[model samples]
Target: MNFAPTPRTTSLRSPEKLRYDKATAYDVLDAAHICHLGYVHDGTPRVLPTAYARIDDRLYFHGSTGSRAFLSARDEGVEVCATVTIEDGIVFARSWFHHSVNYRCVMAHGRARLVQDPDRRLQALAAMIDTLADGRSADSRPPSAKELAQTAVLELALTEVSVKVRRGGPNDDAEDLSLPHWAGHLPLATVAGEPVPDTGIGVRPPPYLP
Candidate 1:
């Protein structure tokens, strides 16, 4: 399935990099652990980094009940944009103008609604834990009533979205190729480090620990 582009989703800057396919958008979102949630509060635009999870065609993010963003969205059902980006490499070119970075990003636009259903909220929370670390939700304790009460979960339908990707080396001018400067892309990635056990825990590390 492909998302029909709207005025907000159409990438006017780089039409070639713009993608309307749902699979591409979902792939970018699945590979990312965090997203930047953009919304307006008090007539001011605000962007906040948040942990999120995608289930089917919906994206879910949670925060403290006292959070201003959540509160505003819950009350007004404000339009929001959720974006996730994964940096793949740093492209270096002989000329600075041609230098760029390789990345995969997805932008989702929708109106966020507070998740009030207990079952749905639980599912979203569990999905979040599992998204961060697969199988971690089963290995850890579930949220208690008090904890659930203090948390605010918001859901945004994935009806409008776009994916953008850039890869390979920099596109340098033909004349600048022989400028005697090295030109190549430095690959980058995110990898897990050694697990550090808690001071009071004697349990063996779970298999899910990367």
Candidate 2:
């Protein structure tokens, strides 16, 4: 289904790159492990980089219970925006003006609320851990009651969202295409290195680690 763009979700720059489909938004969100959360702190706006996970149509993120941004979002129901970006390559062109990046990103706006239900909170926490590695939630120790009490899990609905993507080679002007400077895109990817274990040095890493 296509998400109807609200004023907040509209892209002013490079509107052609904006996508309204749910699949594109979910792909970008699920591929990235972290997101930038933008919210108002006191009278000033702030952006925080934090880990996140998506379950069905909800996005969940956690923080200290005393965090100001979380408190405002949960208690005051203030509007917040979360963004996830995956860079595919670095586009180099003949001219500096044409240099850009090939990337996929999603931006979502909503009023996040703290997950108060114990079962729901546990589900959110499990989903987050499992995102790091499939089946990881079952292998790791569950959070204790005291730890859960100190942690805050916030949920934001997957509405009012937009996905933007940039692909292909550099867009150099016709006149500059003949320049001697190299022109192309360098593909990028995130690769996981061998696991460095601490207390479980002799144990093999879980097969799920990618």
* Top TM-score prediction, candidate number: 1
TM-score of 1: 0.97
In terms of lDDT, the poorest run of 10 residues in model 2 is 69-78
Tens digit of per-residue lDDT, candidate 2, span 1-210:
999999998866888999989999998888888999998877788999988899999999999988887777666566789999899999999999989999999999999888899999999999999888879999999999999998999999988999999998999999997899989999999998888878847757778875
Query: Could you give me the TM-score of model 2 versus the true structure?
Result: 0.96
Predicted structure with the largest lDDT when compared to the true one: 1
The C-alpha lDDT values of all candidates are 0.92, 0.90
TM-score against native, each model = 0.97, 0.96
